[model samples]
Target: MSITIDPVATAGLVSREVRDGSRDGTPTKIAVARRTYDAEQSDLWQAVTSPERIPRWFMPVSGDLSVGGRYQLEGNAGGLVERCDAPESFAVTWEFGGGVSWVEVSLTPADGGTTLELLHESPVDPDFWTQYGPGAVGVGWDLGLLGLGLHLATGATMDPKESEAWALSPEGVEFARHASAGWADAAIADGDDADAARAAGERTLAFYTTPAPTPEA
Candidate 1:
């Protein structure tokens, strides 16, 4: 099982789980985030759609913006757009490799801004859930959405710098800690052992919060 945590790149960002349940092919859920930008939808869409603007907010993205076109980020792998509707909704394969999952993004106009909704769906390893939890993926997406919002609003990019710093912040540490416990509960809900799931969650959080000792060797 692979476990990872990324840092937040923007301020005033919020994220929550919207969907988590069993499905026909894979068990998945939806996570949503809301951010208010001073700009309009047209500019927001460009930041999300245009390659030049992507690195400014999200990862470096390159691919055809049309439906069914393959896309890839420099170090983030590749996927094809399953669907696309200009300035509103778009779907893309969320697969990292080896038949993983797909994540879709839908944009809805809101009060003076836009609401970005993300749906990540695919098969999950029962063992993976028992060890880490949904936050491994969910939290990363949370950070991604935060980056996108900040980019559209301020025309900036925060990658390794913000990611690294966030991993150590008090609030960031607390977030990981609570998120770990929550995901462990979710794993148990999926039929994992209560004790084992909790242990795994605690262990994951410990690993994340633990820092390297000073250079003494």
Candidate 2:
């Protein structure tokens, strides 16, 4: 499907933040992203929580999907649902690559629509943070938010293959670069060195915008 969007404008719609905290006695870094969608609270809530609808914007997910139940996103993280409050908020453990993180999502009425806040908190990895900062996870969520917005506006289920292609397109590259810069600013606001954060953002921009190597014929 062809999509028309203002890459920088859409990237600006999200409010980003980086936070430092502790979880289970381990230092943690939090990436927070907020955006208001042009949908009613109930509709936005359904778009996010309903299994039948998730794949439309995100990815295929399976397994039990309730408090204490386990769920997995296709080719991505799987974890246990820790809490749920219908049409309002949910918290889940994000288990990936043998590391555990926490994700919380909350919805609120705002600007005649709904505002969604996504917070991803994970134990700090010095090596990873030095290389990518918050943009590592933040850019991915930014793309997810973009997909959800597009799905909400058009009521069309996104084609995963097409979505991947778009991410490599010029427009998508612009969006990724803009979003990476936003995350870098957020990191700097949270006490990261300005130059290092900017450098990390550059790396992140390249990471998301780089096309995969072609297979040898």
Candidate 3:
């Protein structure tokens, strides 16, 4: 099934920020994305933190979920919970492969719903940042936010197979383009060269929308 996504609406719903800092003397960059969901802070918190609910929108999670405890995402990253403040915010160590990063999620109440903010901080690897820009991580979170929105609105689990198909569909391509551009803008706002940021954005767009390479004959 083809999913019709509104690129403009999606773009409007998310706000991105890139912040530069240092971690243990290594340069680091934090990519932050915020969006409002049409649900109460409590409900949104449960949707994100509950292991049972996570697989519905994101991926299956296992392990201790409390503060100072470790958690793992099946076939994905695992981490230690650094902080947790119930229906409000949490921070974790996002360990993947041999690299480690940090992720924090915050929730704030709004007029009709809750504002969710995700912050991912990692040591800045020049090569990767130069090639993919913030969309490397930003776009992934953008898609997660999309899934969260759907779950909050419909209370139905999305078919993973269908969601994969949708990502390569025309609408998905457009959405990626918009999201990539948004990340580029955020990078530029964070003092990146505009030309380089736009170029990286194009690469990121291609990465997200392009089909995998076929085997050589």
Model 2: per-residue lDDT, tens digit, 1-217? 5668999999999999999989979999999999999899999999998899999999999998989999999999999999999989999999999999999999999987999999999999999999999999999999999999999999999999999999999999999999999999999999999999999999999999888899999
TM-score versus the correct structure, for each prediction: 0.71, 0.98, 0.95
In the range 1-217, model 3's lDDT, one tens digit per residue, is: 2345586687669999999988899999999999999999999999999989999999889999998899999888999999999989999999998999999999999999999999999999999999999999899888889888888888988778788778888777888888999999999999999999999999999998888888999
lDDT of each: 0.64, 0.95, 0.91
Candidate number with the higher TM-score (1 or 2): 2
Tell me the tens digit of each residue's lDDT in model 1 across 1-217: 1113343333234444434656575666543434555567788778777878777656777778678788888777678888888888788886575665777776678787776666776566667655665556655665566566555645656676666566677767776666566556655675667898788878777767677677987
Candidate 2, overall lDDT?
0.95
Q: Alpha-carbon error at 86 in model 1, in Å?
A: 1.5
**Highest TM-score scorer:** 2
Scored by lDDT, model 3 comes in at 0.91
Clashing pairs in 2: none
Whole-model lDDT, model 1: 0.64
lDDT winner among the candidates?
2
RMSD of each: 5.9, 0.9, 1.7
After superposing candidate 1, which stretches have Cα over 4 Å from the reference? Answer: 1-13, 18-39, 159-162, 169-217
